[model samples]
Target: MTFLRDLLGIPGASSDPAALAAAARDRSGADPDGLPLAVVRAEDIDGVRETLRLAHAHHVPVVPRGAGTGLAGGALAGTGAVVLDVSAMDRIVEIDPVDELAVVEPGVLTATLDAAAAEHGLRYAPDPASAAISTIGGNIATNAGGMRCVKYGVTREAVLGLDVVLADGTLVSTGRRTVKGVSGLDLTALFVGSEGTLGVIVGASLRLRALPERTLTAAAGYDDVASAARACGDLARARRDPAMLELLDGLTLDVIDRAQGTDHGRRSRALVIAQADGPAADAEIAAIAEVLGKEASWVEQGVDAASSDALLAARRLALPSIERFGKALIEDICVPRSRLADAFAAVEEIAAEHRVAIYSFAHAGDGNLHPIIGYSGEARPAGVQRAADAIFRLALDLGGTVTGEHGVGLLKRDWLAREVGPDVLGLHASVKAALDPRGILNPGKAL
Candidate 1:
């Protein structure tokens, strides 16, 4: 324990319940009780290595944390262990415009990288909802997807390489900058969505794409949630590659409108915001508008750069806006594209059956739905748990995943086996045993 103090001073190891409570929860706001004994802030790669070694020796569970904006509670600290806060490691190691790549430390914010790339007329495309605050390490660990995932893919696609420190303080680089390489078994990809189970990411070399020359955004407001699902399905079927396609139901709109004090409550709207970049954007927008018109009340087109950007920003604010109503148990589930409508229908039915308020929104193009349930008053632990289980089970019943972009942190740990059967869960356990045999790296998560 003294060695631990040598690396991370014990003078103020942060045993304060208030500080620990804040570190206990994530954006999901689900059962934030298991607070860690100490919060260890690492300022450099050596510091992270030293901290991991001490934790390994002392058999202390280490939960790697980024910006603490994780919606899945993946960064939640474990009891009587250490919380590894990497936010202090913020740094941009390198930016090679000619190579279309940027090497950044784990703590660098996603939006910060995007802005740096913008200076060179290049952009990082994996823009998650919390890009402004979420760190690149969190994005890489979660393999987070965003509205543009319909066209650009998720964070895993943008990351070319990672500099990881293993459980026992062994440092290694997975993947490379070369455009193509098959020398290894793609260990880097393994670590991308591993949720910090295999190692602690110190830095990453990410791929960047040229910024779009022109952009057009259009919003199609549907009268109901099902119709909105139909519009999303149609676009996917027609092979329309809109950069961003999101849906917000009436309840979601009402919450956002009331929260933001806007006039967007005239209809039961399932709004779809799409972006068409490049020279072919005009024609693409036309086809998209025609398809959306089939199911929406109206397709409002905004070609002006400012107007389109503003609408996209507003759409991103949906979840945060919805949080104003009550405490949220945000459920992230993804079904197949064709099953999007069925998923929405099932979600609506479940909310009605349980008599709970659910506001839905999603990257509909990819079939990733977020059914955020509002719970106020006294925290009925059992009731809240039941509603979340029902929503996740519905997604699994429809041949969908229990989680889309969000990882199986503390919140969805119970439902993990439901989505991935016992056998697969066992396989995951075996891998976990091999990588972190002592189970010191973020134990009781994703297992």
Candidate 2:
């Protein structure tokens, strides 16, 4: 308590349940426990530095939180820790339209930054589905990916420079404002997905792209998931890359149709929406449709912005809509593009074997799939656990990762050893020891 007051300059840092509750449960809904000794709302970079120094000296675990929107338990607090809430530091430091770059505080929301970039005819393209509420810091921490990642890349690609506060209160700047540079070791890349295990992110300068002049969209309805998966495989083999390619199974489509009152033009057991920009947009959509025709039940094209947004909104609202049924345990798994069909088939098999309801969706352009297992009542604990284990084991068997975008927070820690061998885990521990020997920064996360 004394450390929090002295370093953060906040009087009530010791007593605040509302703030603690907000920082405790992320989107994961992992059973929240162990209230922090205190919550520190850092207002600026200096404030972050001061808190770290105090924490390092006091040997108290510091859990960094941003908007608490992470699908993983990355933002969940541990026992006897200080919850470092940075959402209060929201601010845009600078925007250079000519250079196509923007400097922003870590607390700024992802959607807010993208909207600001649009004013200059430029945009930051690494948009996770939770862009409306997720923070840039959390995005960087998880190395988030979204629909456009098939073309634009992930959060790590957009980040040009990072201002970080080390465990010992040292402030370090990595990368540059320029387009390219190779001066030293890529420390910036190291911290991007470290999940707050290495340091506290204070500020960042992000790379931006020119806004698209035109966008062409199409929705292809398939007879089954196999058809959609096969179409994705064909596109990859042909080396045809669309700006966005997303898949939604019928179970998910049904939820969206009921919740959002939207229509997909045709009833499809499996659906894929492909989008492209520039003058070749129409051609790209046509080619994607042609490739999907081999197995599609029906195919329709959406040309105007309104229709496109509405179609995309259905895909975006899938999670929330599915949540209406009951609690959903989302599984994010990624396999090699060629093996996507196999992965999809494995998920179906696991659901059948466990007798559980699992709805599937994904950024099919890449092989990142989200398989959500729904639970209706509390009596099915054994069934839910069995389903989760089966799906994760299936992912590992297919040479895919347990988590594609979300970090290995508390929930996925047990799977880490199976995915990466003991030697790699040892290396991770060595690095953690070198940076944070005290283990006072987001302990039990990542490594």
Candidate 3:
């Protein structure tokens, strides 16, 4: 403890019970094996390097953390480990409209970056629901995707370069500021979704987009979730490139209705929300509404900005609204666009078979579903685990990954091998070993 304080300065390190308890868990609902020894709040890149240097020398495990809004248990710290907190490093170093990039610290809030970009007539396209609170470092660690991902892609797509601290506390810069570069091994892409196992991200240069000239939103309601999912596929097949496309199941709509005092569920069992931006925004949404109307019970097109926000609220409020029912174990599974309907059907069957309450929503255009399993009590119900397992298996069966946006933290570690096969899994092990021979950086998580 004294050594850590000396390395990071007194204000940067703490062994306080409250700090340890807060750092011990994330929003994943998985309890930490035990509390961390201490929480070191690193305010700068030098502080991060110093803490890692000490941890490497002492052979102590370190868990690099951002805002703690991660859906997977990637940031959870356990006994004998040090929680390296970087949320205090929030700073937007520069926003270059000429180069269409933003240089930022790892701790900068996702929304803050977008807002700053907006001031320069640009926008940050990745918008995970947690963007309002989630940090860029955490997004990069998990390679998070949001509603806008259907068009702009995920965090990896926005990142132009990174300043990473390796396992041995060696600071290395990978990637470039230009739009395209393939100089070497492409280590930047490798570390983007590594879940902090190989290294800790300290700073990033992010790509930005010009603000759209116009924007429009449209929504449709269906009698069943499968129909709504199919509508998403239909829009994709028709080559309608929407900036955002979201789907909410009946149970999810009900929960949101109760929480927000809206009547979305009463109107239909399912809802599909779509947003189009740029020069042809109006024409694109009209086409989207027409395609949705083929299978939809009701369709609302060209909605006013306020009404569009009201419609989009269902997706933004999904996880929190479901949590109101009870503790929610949110599961992320993505399937091929052609099989989204089949995947949703399997989720319904799994929920019924296990007798658990599962409310699902999706970034439908991308086939990423978030099926939240709600339960009561201090201990997670066995049926909840069963239902979640069944969901993961079905996703694999449908040729989809177990996780779409969220990284395979402690919760999804067991199913990773089954999805990637032994050969690829061995490759993962090889990579981990080469990068972190001592295995002190975020051990026993992503791999």
Candidate 4:
């Protein structure tokens, strides 16, 4: 403790129970093994290096925490670990519109960077639901994707480079500042989704895109989720490219309807919302509405800026809305786009078999479904695990992944082996051994 104070200083580090408790757990509400030794509020990159150097010297595990909004328990600290909270390092170092890149400190919020970029008629495209509060570092760590992922791509694609502090507190830069680079093994990408298991991200260079000239939105309600899923395939087959393609199940709709006093709760089996942005948005939106009419029982224009915001607002409210029922475990499983309907059918069966309430919703274009399981209790109900396992198994069976946006983190580590096979699992271990031989970085997370 004295040695830690020597580097972090008295004010920079705190072992107070309140601080320890806050730092030890994350948004996932996971019960960590125990309280961390302390939390160091790193004010800059040098502070990060000092903290990691202390951690490595003392053989103490370190967990990097951003805004603490991660759902995957990636930031939960192990027993006696030190939580290096990087939120204090917030800074927008540069934004070069000509180069189409923004360099920022790890603690900068995703929305903050976008807001700055918007001033110059540019935008960062990932746009995760928690973008308002989630830090860019966490986004890169999890390779987060949002509704925009259907067109602009995920966090990994938008990330151009990273400055990482490795296990020994050595700051290393990776990747190129330019758009194109194939110089070597993309260590930048390797760290992007590592979920803080290998190094602590100190800074990043992100790709930006010009603002869309126009935008259009549309929504369709189906008698069954299968029809809505089919509509997704239909639009894709028609060579449509929407900025956002989302599917909401009847249950999620019911929650939204109840919360907002809307009529969607009464009859909608599934609702699909799509967005088109750019010069041809109007025509694209019209064509999307036409396709929806072919299979949807209820069709409406999700147009206008206000309406577009409301639509996305409703989608973002899906998780907390369902949590009102009971304790909710949000599961992110991605199946083949064509097999989304089948995955939904399988989820329905699993929920019924387990007698648990599971509400489904997704980025339909990408086949990423969030089947949230809710049950009453502080202790996890047995049926919840069954339902969660069933969803992952179903995804795997359908040639899909166990997780789409959320990293493996603490919850899905076991599923990683099943998803990647023994050989790939072994390779993951090899990489882990190579990068974090001391095992001081984020112990017990992300394989």
lDDT score at residue 414, model 3, on the 0-100 scale: 86
Number of clashes in model 1?
A: 0
- What's the candidate order when arranged by decreasing TM-score? 3, 4, 2, 1
List all candidate RMSDs to the true structure.
2.0, 1.8, 1.4, 1.4
Q: Write the per-residue lDDT of candidate 4 for residues 1-447, one digit (tens) a residue.
A: 566567457347887889888888777857898888889998888888888887788888899999988888999986778899999889999999999899999899999999999999999999888999999999999999998999999999999999999988999999979999999898998998999988999999999999999887888889999999999999988888888899998988898777777777576788898999999999998988888779898887856898877766668778777776677887799988999999888998999999988999999999999898887879988888888998999999999999999888998888988999899988888898898888999988887
Give the alpha-carbon lDDT of every model.
Answer: 0.82, 0.84, 0.90, 0.88
Q: Give all TM-scores, in the order shown.
A: 0.95, 0.96, 0.97, 0.97
**Candidate 2 segments whose C-alpha is farther than 4 A from its true place:** 1-8, 11-14, 261-266, 377-380
Relative to the true structure, candidate 2 reaches a TM of: 0.96
lDDT of 2 by residue, 1-447 (tens): 677567546532544777667666788868657777678888777778778888999998899988888877988885678888888778989989999999999889999999999999988899898899999999999999999999999889999999999898899999999989999998899899899999999899999999988887778888788888889888877777689999888778887888877765248788888888766777887887788677888877777788778667778789998898788887798887778888888888888888888888988888899999888864546777788877778778888898889878888888888899899999999989998899988998888
> Which ten residues in a row are the worst by lDDT in model 1?
4-13
Candidate scoring better on lDDT of 2 and 3: 3
Best of the two (1, 4) by TM-score: 4
Off by over 4 Å in 4: 1-11
TM-score of 1: 0.95
Question: What C-alpha lDDT, on a 0 to 100 scale, does residue 237 get in candidate 2?
Answer: 78
User: How many clashing pairs per prediction, in order?
Assistant: 0, 0, 0, 2
